[model samples]
Target: MNITIYDVAREAGVSMATVSRVVNGNPNVKPVTRKKVLEVIDRLGYRPNAVARGLASKKTTTVGVIIPDISNIFYAELARGIEDIATMYKYNIILSNSDQNAEKEIHLIHTMLGKQVDGLVFMGGQISQEHIEEFEHSSVPVVLASAIEPTGKIPSVNIDYRQAAADAVAMLTDAGHTDIAFVASPLKDTINQHVLSGYYEALEAAGIEKKDELVIEGDYTYDSGIEAWSRLQELSSPPTAVFVNNDEMAVGVIHGAQDNGVHIPDELEVISFDSSRLALMVRPQLTSVVQPLYDIGAVAMRLLTKYMNKEKVETPIVVLPHHIEKRGSTK
Candidate 1:
């Protein structure tokens, strides 16, 4: 059902390079050989890959998209933005999931590069030194979307995660809840670490000592939020308010509390980040830090296009704005 250059070459008893040369309109091939290749191509219904056709012009017109998990709503929306912009610029997308694994991330980078994509848009958590080295070595341009590279060496798009976390914690404290808890993502993550730091800063500002029992690490999942709440319920003095890392986990925290017959806001107040659509999908709604997820993805793609097209980019690191979405989740 499909044809390739190799099929044409084998059918015509010609080399692959010869087929390439003929397809590219290179006059170096003999007239007879060119005509034979053309006939084979036509008879085999072999349509040249558009990217291959544009290679002579030094453009593949295709971009690789590396995301942590396409199943995640946050990344899915971001991917949509990237794909939409890429389509506008007439670029095809090649998507792959790294599953937030470092080794897999590196492997995907190499794989995408091997595909000869003109550029890449990457989204992940905790970009490592190895990632930095790989991006530095890439022949094609790479832009990070809603991801962080601690060294600030890579071109990326994100919001001020630390400040956002601090603001959310302050709001919880301002409501007269001294026993505030922090539901965090993977502790190793740079953004999570910053968010945790902001939480501590908020506590310190109010002259509250950090409580080791109040901090729980979650995996940015509803189940984790539920687990965090379960753990909090065991504490001698459970928190009256909590700062959750994401909406999914925040929802879990709420349900976790309700499952145990604990009333929300009346007994526990919850605030979350990423003001993703999930924030609004739950009952009583979620109060969260609104992130420009689509804009981050769209802007990252545009920045990558600029690099791929050899256009000038004044700033490599782009930090989008973030705001808190006040809702029923918090008092």
Candidate 2:
């Protein structure tokens, strides 16, 4: 009652080796042979035994993806892209959340490696030297997706955060907003530092004196954004426009301002990064930068696959493009 490779081969009038090649997705098989073998396999309801095949070939044909938070729309969309591409390549994905903790991330890496994943796609706020060292010694291929490690040795796919942030600020300045504020998470992270630097650079270019009072830090959460707005409002002269590091915080800022009787765009303009779905969900849709998070994840997975196959990759670092999507939040 159970069907196997032998049944498929016998039905197709082909040798077992030829059936094996067809099942493994080999391109050398002639089209007619492939079609005939597939028809036989389908008719017999024979399925390839992935576990047995992996034991023989030492490859699981699976990818492990680790992200900081899947609740965030940005990361959720990114994971979708990775899954789509992995499915295309006949591979499966094992997804996990690291909560952006370095120790937890390292532990997850070891666990995934123990499971013998063919490759890994990692995304987090900060990657420590220990992580880099572990990855350097890893037998499997690893790629950073929307995350940057301190060491530039690992392959990565991301947009130019510094440039993207700078461009957003420049746009705000050109729109006649002289007084601006930069709201971000901790600057200890390298990516956050680059974004903040861009904000400062744009202000300098526009001849606007940088005000320390206007620079506030949030934890990239909606609650933290509310706190940041409260702190900014207490200042002697509040900023007319604010650049938030993420859409979650931007939503909080918008709501917080409205609660304090401040009108968006007319009284206070807000811009955030990562044009996630939440950007459109807000009452006054957030004007934000598009990070192309999905593309970053997909490309990183592709690069890891190439590395796993011992193929030459064209580039170690792939920088995707980003742009601003204007909406109701910004003038």
Candidate 3:
């Protein structure tokens, strides 16, 4: 037989209202009463009816998370963190992939809203002004995870890409590598631009002349990485070191270099951002910048919960810290 709130209240010798307060995690009840009610609840194996509870509170207790690509290890780990926290808070998550398309993002947002999600978490390349305007009219709260727009009006959780990239480049330059190449995704995206800018700044600071021929653009894909590596090798003078934007492409670059009879960390050193599991799977292993992807997702969910509860959050925009993981990929 399923246990009910009435059973918990009767067992605890408290009124139904007191039991309700304890179950809802309300702090208004006395500690003794709360403890007693919790004991009764645990002993009886009582489970709160989420649907009824939501109706009574006028909240769905569901958060919608929209990520650019679910298959990507970065987003996958982030979703795991978000789901873990949501479960801890007795909330469910509705997850979707947007493919980093603005139109798809917009459509997913509307779909999630229509589903009556109490809050939203979005992760992508760049959220446009039009998207922000549309969200402003949304009744539910929305938070950005691992994404940032220039306006800085919306709440977001991300690391300083520019600084992280700069640090990576600086590490190579410090290792006596003057011929360095930056392999990045499309610079049209805001996040990619920040990383590229960091690379440029680091090179300029190191007094290393920027070579247009050395910079290669990839779509953050393994195939793109291979193609970019081929193109870079075809150049009259190939770079001694390469900094890739992501681990997937970095792996591709490594393989491409090997196929071309290049030795890692000797003939060609490679490093990338996003310290994913793939970093360790490689032969020499990839040295990468570790972005707190899970923390970003968890914190974004927490902030969205606060917003849903009408609570004041200290900071709307959260910049998480990142660090480089030194490995065999770079000298």
Candidate 4:
């Protein structure tokens, strides 16, 4: 019988992600979990190197990855997953940052194509027509992580941004916060737009009138989040709770409220998206929507491998699950 990671995980009562982290030497896994997974691996004789074992005679190719910013913890986590899988598949990664700029993204695509990369993995906020054109013209397979391609023409891996955002807002609404505010990333980005719609959807469902001033635009930075919070404070009817787009911005909002002598989850409840490591690092740790960032990247790379090898693919679009992680920041 073939031993697989899934079998190992099932035996150990852990997630496949935990097994992957243990195999990949990711430090985030709890010590007990790591020990358990390692024990299961030893007992089951399971190896995660099945791809390499099968492709012993395969040539080592390259996969070009275009990211928005590596400095962001969210992107950094995703990058780690991509690199690990690429390494397992004996594919070298040529990484570049596009900074979520359209022209730069387009140029990177052409440049990666010029290098004859075997595949491409892209992460960005919006998928413009130019991007679609480039993807259509590219000879190599392309996949997106944490990006939504409206046309469904491109293969991608991501979570349901809309439903996650709705859940965040609804959580606050359930806590009896009628005056909830939102610190959003740029609405121009499709992901943010989806989140925006979900925010309204939640408000509409609760019969709470959406206040215009409560929706503040942010640049997905700590400073932007602080500024958004500051603007909300200046309002005649300040928000009792705020939903931020990402962890960094959420931390900024928390600190901003603290600086003004507002106690978290007391005077100002908060919820944010992307429960990255930064979420736990902050004081009064954030209650956030946990996005399986690494999983998204890992799955996207795996899918690209399928295309590169001309294997059968069942789905071109994949939506991973996301859920709320309640913590000190929310009631």
- Models 1 onward score TM values of 0.87, 0.86, 0.84, 0.82
**What lDDT is reached at residue 182 by model 2?**
88
Clash totals for all models, in order?
A: 0, 0, 0, 0
Give candidate 4 misplaced runs (Cα > 4 Å): 1-60
lDDT of 3 by residue, 1-331 (tens): 9888888888899998898788788899998888888988989999997656666677778889999899998889999889988998878998999998999999999999887789899898877888888677888888988887888888888999999999999999988889899999887788999999999999999999999888889988999989889999988888999999999999999999999999998888888999988899998999999998789889988888889888989999999999999999776
Compared to the true structure, candidate 3 yields what TM-score? 0.84
**Where is the poorest 10-residue window by lDDT in model 3?**
49-58
Over 4 Å off, model 3 = 1-56
TM-score of 4: 0.82
lDDT of 4 by residue, 89-125 (tens): 9888999999989999999999987766789999999
- Native-vs-model 2 lDDT? 0.89
Report, for every candidate in turn, its global Cα lDDT versus the true structure: 0.89, 0.89, 0.89, 0.91
TM-score of 1: 0.87
lDDT of 3 at 141: 88
- Of 2 and 4, the candidate ranking higher by TM-score: 2
Judged by whole-model lDDT over C-alpha atoms, candidate 3 comes out at 0.89
Q: Which stretches of candidate 1 lie over 4 Å from their true place?
A: 1-46
What is the lDDT, from 0 to 100, of the residue 230 in candidate 1?
A: 93
